[model samples]
Target: MEQPTLSRATNPLIDALVLQHLQKRFPQSAECLQRELASRDAAAAAPPPTNRHALLMLLAPPGDETPLWATAYAEVRDWVDGALDTEGARYKPELSRLLWPLFAYTYLELLRAGAREQAGGFFASFHADHALMRRDELNQLSQVSSAEQVDASEFARRLLTSRYEVRLSAFSRALLLGFVAERRLQLTLRMLNERIKLALPETLAPSDGGGPAAVALEDD
Candidate 1:
């Protein structure tokens, strides 16, 4: 089912007001708004087009096609499911650690995609996943709902900019990346590039202490 779209055109006066607000209140993103208008079907009826037919286009400022979070979230969700399934099960414990960060990123991606309401819903639907181990991070992530909120929340900002520590033996990392890459899970690759750092050991030997372990962050 299609999610409702937030952007729209209105009656002439309201349309002008919307344009003015975009240009005046968000000058930096104004160009994106302009390009959004420019790239649409050039011949569509002006005042009624967005309101009538192309609301999803409003969700993306201009060039981006129905922001990735809109549809791809489900794809990425399924991809994660596949990555943790029988074929990839050997790395399940190590890969499991990425879940919390991936969970946080899902919300960010939804926000960046301009699916604010959807982001909230997505978060609510999965809130139970935040167990005792993830309480702090979960609390921090819960405070964020928009792009500005991300900048304001230190934890949210770190989730976006810092490297998520994925502790795994070298062989596991190779297997995971190689499988995803070979399978062409593009969104998973994007997640790795944007949200995590693969933390490996200095030596390839098995951990003297058993297997890899998650080190608590200074804040945690």
Candidate 2:
């Protein structure tokens, strides 16, 4: 079946604010995303387990035309459905595995924002964890490791790289308060993306051939 293409103009004000946060706050992580894009070679793709489907559905951001959530929902949904068959069978993992690495970028940004510290701990609340895992029995979900061997430096590098690539998703990059506070903008964008990706619907991914499609929210 053919799908509707949800394209639009970029919002410079929003983009500019986002960039400002990334440049000033999470400089290192922003750099990493940029580097990965520039190299045209990303870290190895991680295999998707059965539980990921639920994560995608739950974390998906709520939007269809905005760049970050829209693109992320589409990409994540594409990866999950492509992994399953009509009879609900499993297929070997593919390059779509990039999603895991991408989310790792999100995780890094959140750490920079100090989300853990804000909530009185260094990780998300156990309640949030339970909600995310309930989707797949996710008993093994949290136990699973992120795709890359990440550290603070690596996170900063990826984020900066994405900023330079200028193709980042709005869902993944936009956060609460919309950059009123610069200190945590980078991490806030990252976490918002992660949460929205967790809530994505299955209809987001495109069916045509192209590099993975990204929704640019700015109006041109």
Candidate 3:
């Protein structure tokens, strides 16, 4: 077997590219990125699992970001509800599945930032509302007998893109965990979820979940 050599020669360029990509994908994230960097750096020095999850959770919050998260959550729910396939979504199904816990954490983060009472409960209510709205929309469209029914392509585009946006917040968090925390991707996500429960008790609990367990990364 051939040995793989590592190089820091391109590290600077790669870091720049990562920043550029992040900025482009999330224009609003520029403000919080400094904090994100500090967190990432801190996380880099930490041992496995402790700082791992918080770092991943931190990825979604810089510069008032939310759209990507909204899309991603929608997609995740779709998969959960059997509307999409494990293979049909954007990120790897296993990776995506493991990272699902961040959605609740992101909502909790937003709630805490506002200091509204019953924040966790409110966010949970909103999630339920969003789910109902989505179901209703789908059902109404299915019953449309007129030629004025929305185009399938347009419908798909809307669903996929919105779902993509929702999921992006969580995905970025996972990416941060993967690149900075140095944990294997699946373990990183698992760490993120478990950490969320520890870091924000109002947002998540062990029993609040019925999702997939963390899987081993493919290359391992």
Candidate 4:
């Protein structure tokens, strides 16, 4: 028997109609067409390639004395701070507020990891930048040298347990998110996803009003 073959016209509607007709007239070809359709659909639905390096690095056991958390934290923080600092002054205030919470959590995360020396260096390097807004909290947090201290201190415990909220204009939120995604800063992304709560306002009001918006700040 001569088998029927479909001639693809490239028009979705026409192709579907032809496929249906072929299937009805030739039951054997139906299975082949169905498989092809399934393959195409699966390909279309597959997710884009993701950079899993950061996630893997975070989840993998530390095989050496390297302070992965502290290093990741510093890279993410410095990039974010530099990013916001370069933005227009108008959006700077709303976006820059993210730094404080990020800083606090990064420092605490280092301490919790038993990277006391790394944590101290991190604190000293950036504490002054946040001192104006979080001086007392910074001072108190600096005293926390280990995970045991974090558990015992009320201030440290509260910050770790609670989510820090930040509002951002929709545009600002997109810009920030796009930057992180492009950079593949998974640790920073994890922090934003798990620890920070973002409040996105629909419309950013100029002057008087406005709106919008990792490191794998994780524990062992």
Identify the leading candidate in terms of lDDT. Answer: 4
Residue-level lDDT tens digits of model 3 in 1-220: 2211111122332334334434544443333333334444453423332343443444433454333334444444443445323332233333343333344334433343553343334344444533432454334333322223323334322332232212223233323432432322232233343333211112111222223232112111
Which regions of candidate 2 fall more than 4 Å away from where they truly are? 1-83, 87-92, 117-155, 162-220
Provide the clash count, candidate 3: 12
lDDT of 2: 0.32
User: How big is the positional error of residue 2 in model 3, measured in Å on the Cα after superposition?
Assistant: 24
Error of 4 at 51 (Å): 10
The numbered model that scores best in TM-score is: 4
* Candidate 2: 10-residue stretch with minimal lDDT: 87-96
The C-alpha stretches of model 4 lying farther than 4 A from their native spots are 1-89, 201-203, 206-220
Give the TM-scores of the predictions, in the order they appear.
0.54, 0.23, 0.25, 0.60
Taking every candidate in turn, the Cα RMSD to the unseen true structure, in Å, is: 16.6, 17.8, 16.8, 15.8
TM-score of 4: 0.60
| Model 2, span 1-220: residue lDDT tens | 3311112222333434444445554554344323433343233222223343433333344442122322343344353445233322211122222333334344443343434332222124222422432333223233323333223244334443443122222222222112212222232244434322222223323222112332112211
**Candidates ranked, most accurate by TM-score first:** 4, 1, 3, 2
lDDT against the true structure, per candidate, is: 0.52, 0.32, 0.34, 0.55
Candidate 1, residue 179: Cα displacement in angstroms equals 3.6
Which ten-residue region of model 1 has the weakest summed lDDT?
1-10
